[model samples]
Target: MNSEEGRSRPAWGYQALVSLPARTSTPTRELGRRALFALGLLVITVGLVYFDRGAYQDNNADHVVSLVDAIYYATVTITTTGYGDITPVATHARIINAILITPMRILFLVLLVGTTLEVLANEGRRVFRDARWRKRMRNHIVVVGYGTKGRAAVKTLEKNNCNPAQVVIIDGRPSAISDANIGGYAAIEGDATRRDILRRAEISKAREVIITLDRDDSAILVTLTVRQLNPSAHVVVAVREQDNATLIRQSGADAVVTSSDAVGRLLGLSAVSPNLGTVIEDLLSSGDGLEVSERQVTADEVGKSPGEVMGERVVAVVRNKTLRRFYDPTVARLETGDQLVVVRRSDQAAAPLPSGGERREFGGRRGR
Candidate 1:
């Protein structure tokens, strides 16, 4: 199993045991073998301990073997740290001693060595695979900044079940250390604005370039460079001020998120009409929030008025730099340079009509 799969599985205590019985018989039998091996070593060690007693009692020809001394000598012998405090005097006992424990000692060493080597081999293979992954990747998403919004975006992408191997991030400031959690996702340390740093991040091949830098100017520059390198890439730039949104969008960004405008409107609406705000919040959030969507009227809706396109309310229609209130969708005209803000009904796809208002691309296309 791969490391990720192994980690995802239940702990060893709960998982079904495998290959154990075939190699070593039942658990009882395995325990018995281990016990025998241990007992054999104990016997050889006890012989060594009694050897000391034999030395003092050689003239008497009788030496009592104490259990405590046997245990001490057993530990010393198994560890191969015999202190010379014990010696065997009887020739037959010494010869029998070597016969009993030497084979068991060799078997223990072999098992320990094999297990250690196997562990080392598995670890080495994992390191090699990680290195290979780092060297071979391109056209992936590279998050260039780290903050609450950046973290939320990364998490949302991950939650969508996107492959980790396809995402990369670049952030140089020490404050962006939290981004390290995405280690398996490609990462590099350097200034994102520097063309060389962007090149190292493989910006040319990236599918999406997100500029959520803490500073607006940095985001603007990053947006410009990314558009110049990969004009087709969908770039999402975050602007702290609402006015900067147009600037970022004009710099070749597909979309721009205004933090202040969103936050301020949310707070203001919540204060006057909390219930309405809650409903809107749900739509904006992952939950069942009201989804405010926009679609440019295509050829189908060319003759039809705004009411047919927006079944409910036509909040506002934009023509050039002018913004006009259009409460009545029936009277609103679908003309060039006109954008209709409509509330979605049931997550259904809205049909497009012939363009009459401003030529505006809502979801997919960006106005150049």
Candidate 2:
């Protein structure tokens, strides 16, 4: 989207969108491959002329075609720079030149010109692709920031069967945007605090927004803007200070993760009790060891106490959008409609998405 259309753009900033699962090749690598092909053609031409040296004439180095002369002749011929010093005198040699050398020359020139055209064509394709992607973007996730926390959030999403194509990134740093593109996610290059930038990402239509900006103030501003644009979108923000989490949540963030405090707590646990810390870390990390999952309660488990449930350890139960610890008296019995957050071995089969369950999403009713 144009800045003028957004009415909230900075004078110096512009939007650059990159969509996911992009099949891209570096310009240098493409060019190098083409160059090798061109070189191979030259080599073939040189070999043909050298083998039939008796049918050629080199005015500069006697009537005989030396290896050097054949190389020079091939180079000039393929480049269409016929210096007239080397001439194919025999009828067979002339025929060979017409049939083989001429086509190779044309192909070589086309290769050179095609490279330039490819670069321009790629730009037009990129613009067209971006337009299509923007039009189709709806109910997608927008990740504002590409730092460590943001990266981890995306990784977790992917681990849980989330398509990387369903995520968009918004970052002020060009390098971060580039990384997002490389990682197969559409990205907008600009400050997340800017409404125009968010609009470029189609934040109004996004299903969720994750803000992991460098500062708490920026996170709050972004949360407010996103909530203003999309009131129903579940907004999650990460802050360095625990004290700012409440303010961020008040600013419309559905959930706030204090990055610094969480890490510090982990460090403290690791220092005091290594095994407990390691187990906690394992639960938090995906893809190995034990994993925490949310699944719908089976019909057989209805009215059963949390302790009676088998196959996995039930830690919490969710019913009617309320979270209840498994040990809580209110959630002592598992209801058929309730969802359970359980800890299971990574090798175990994962629970399917429940008809009414929120995974990695904040689900408590908060005062607005």
Candidate 3:
């Protein structure tokens, strides 16, 4: 059994659901351009009719054509809804109608209906692409929540070279999904505990599942559902209470993080010794501090001891899918296929350690 099998799980619960603003697409610049073009065409057509007033007549009145009448005539003619209340009488007016007015009407139609057609075409393309993406999605990671812990875990995964495109987010809140979409991750908005929602996320084909639901009960249910759907996939969960850890493990969680107890211990350590707390924090953080990384053992170091490896501090070794401490007698002599879990500077490039070299300590100021 794995060392994490007996660890306590946290018992955090989801808070009351809050309504978030629905995502709305703003008017595109193309639509605005089309509108302005159509407006200009209307204005020019009205002006032409107004100036050539002597060539036209209003059937309803004996009075000369007015600006309102000119605009009304232009509107109806361009819309192809000719009311027959206005007519061009002179030969020049008839010729101009065939040449200029007809083309203007065609242009107006294109501008007005073109936008609607483009919108529909783009929507069709989007649907087709989404369908294709779903079919090709496999060995991806599904994140059940977008809360603080979930977000942090995602960031860490991304920092460690995991592809953001392969990460799927499932959250109940629309705002959380919107945020995930904005960050370029695929997101499904629904209750994660539901089987249908998990199915929609392609849970069966996923390689890993991260459950960060707020409620311990919800987390357990989701874990059970996910385990049933994908028995082989690794499942990691966070709970707030220690007592519920066993339940989560029984539910088939491969790893459990007891957030409350971890935080409490950190606080106590910080109060007792500030430097020790800072060192632990540095080890947990990435980018500007020490980070924990795992890599396969190099061929040249196949028969060497972990203590003989220069530069990095090897904490543990993974061999044949089992973890062994660096100090373990069985692990003392490094093997060809063993994976080393070591602590190194976050910004340092990974390279094979030189033989018979001394260990180097990395500190914030020194690394900088």
Candidate 4:
């Protein structure tokens, strides 16, 4: 194929249709035909009324009004609203009446009824569909924002079988709403930082909420709103600045995603272990394969060791300011409130680390 043909090949499906060239006949002829047809219909109705007026004789005149009055009556009656103020005195006048008026009246009523019923039927179907969708959704991840980071988070949720239907996105931008399929997914248009919008998306009912907006302030606001609306909900807020991660966590986010920290680690890994970096990227960015998970060691997991509970291996641990590696069974003992980051395949199921152990002040650890 030539270069032009090769360039055109990529355009197909809905995208191709939208990119196709517009034809002059498409809009021009359609509008012209409609305008002409409406004018013709109006002229015919007026002519028929004039013909009917001439037929009314002196016998009709005794109780009759003017021709204008008869035309007004015809207009009102055709609208399916007979005021009953004027009556046709003669049998011939009512019998051999305007050819268009009766059928036009019937058509008008039919159109009115049809439009009304269609709207009601459509609204009913929407309600039923939304109810079904909401029912099938449980513990589904809800993501706020659809920027670069937010889109990445969505892919992660889907890769982990989070259920596409259960995923609800709350973003203020209309363009973001239009980008994805959005057919089965529920997306609300509003500022995620606003409490009303969060409530509208049923944040309290959401299993998890991830805020990945570009602005740190926006993310912080969203984290605060979600915490107040849903204290139990697992909230993950993204922070571009490394220093802001702790602030985000303090603002009620269960966890903070630091892009700087992540990219820095990734670059370091790529230098020492290129193959490992590739594997990690594929797992995080793709829809299948391995996934990253982080869970805080609660008071419940204090006494248990990592090997005893976590099926996956710990990648790293953040204890105080030091980075520690998972050594063996002895080091596996997790204190209460230690953050553990682990990597596991998507299909593999895992139980939470053991619960109910002695609390300690080893700071915290970030496990891979």
lDDT of 1 by residue, 1-368 (tens): 89999899889787776634224254445445666666665676566555544432223224464566566655665656767554455776567557855655565555444544555576679779766755676667878886777766676566445577787777886446444553456666788888888877778888987777888889999989888887778898889998888888888888889988988998899899987677656555542323444445455555556667645445566556455666555436667445666555433333333443332212211111
Candidate 2 lDDT, 158-206, residue by residue in tens: 7666888889999988789889999999899998888899999999999
- TM-score ranking from best to worst? 3, 2, 4, 1
TM-score of 4: 0.60
Model 4 residue runs over 4 Å out of place are 1-16, 19-63, 67-72, 75-107, 127-138, 178-183, 268-276, 279-283, 287-325, 328-368
Per-model TM values vs. the true structure: 0.45, 0.64, 0.68, 0.60
For model 2 the local lDDT of residue 328 reads 95
Candidate 4, residue 14: the lDDT equals: 40
lDDT of each: 0.64, 0.84, 0.85, 0.66
Segments in model 2 whose C-alpha atoms lie over 4 Å from true places: 1-121, 349-368
Number of clashes recorded per candidate: 20, 0, 12, 12
lDDT of 4: 0.66
Displacement of residue 357 (Cα, Å) in model 4 is 23
TM-score of 3: 0.68
What is candidate 2's TM-score against the reference?
Answer: 0.64
Query: What are the runs in model 3 whose C-alpha is more than 4 Å off?
Result: 1-119, 350-368
lDDT of 3 by residue, 123-174 (tens): 7798898899899899999999999988888887776568998999999998
Across residues 206-238, which tens digit of lDDT does each residue of candidate 4 receive?
A: 889889888898888889888888889888888
